[model samples]
Target: MKRLFLVLIPLALLAGCLEVDQHPHWVKGQYAGKKDDLPFQTHFHRDRLSWWGTISNRNQHQNEYNRANP
Candidate 1:
């Protein structure tokens, strides 16, 4: 049992060291990961004014005086 453990433990430790690196491959000046879509594009259907209005309302609600007065 001791001999089995000694052989298997070294083999298990070496298994991890032998793996190939998983760095992303880049295509000349091209992004290789997730595309960053604008929040307004997805959530507000690209209506710039509506997105700004929603942001303004959110910020106003976060103010302590606004909450107290309203």
Candidate 2:
């Protein structure tokens, strides 16, 4: 039991140094992804009001209070 403790104690202490640096390479305000567009720009043809109404109605349907009342 004493030998097991001596081996495990040092092994556990040195295990943390094996980790590689995982920080992102881009931190200087330059995006490295593809260009994106608004959700409603293509589907709803840039109709913000219609897109907002759809989102609001979907949220209402998912509400617990609205479901219990109905």
lDDT (Cα) of model 2: 0.88
Give the per-residue Cα lDDT of candidate 2 at 45: 94
Best by TM-score: 1
Which lDDT value does model 2 have at 63? 92
Query: Residue by residue across 1-70, what tens digits does model 1's lDDT show?
Result: 9999999998998888978988777789776888788999999998989999999999999999978955
Residue pairs with clashing backbones, model 1: none
Off by over 4 Å in 2: 27-51, 64-70
C-alpha local distance difference test of each model = 0.89, 0.88
lDDT of 1 at 9: 94
Q: 26-53, model 2: which lDDT tens digit per residue?
A: 6578756656879988789999999999
Inter-residue clash pairs, candidate 2: none
CA RMSD for every model? 3.7, 4.0
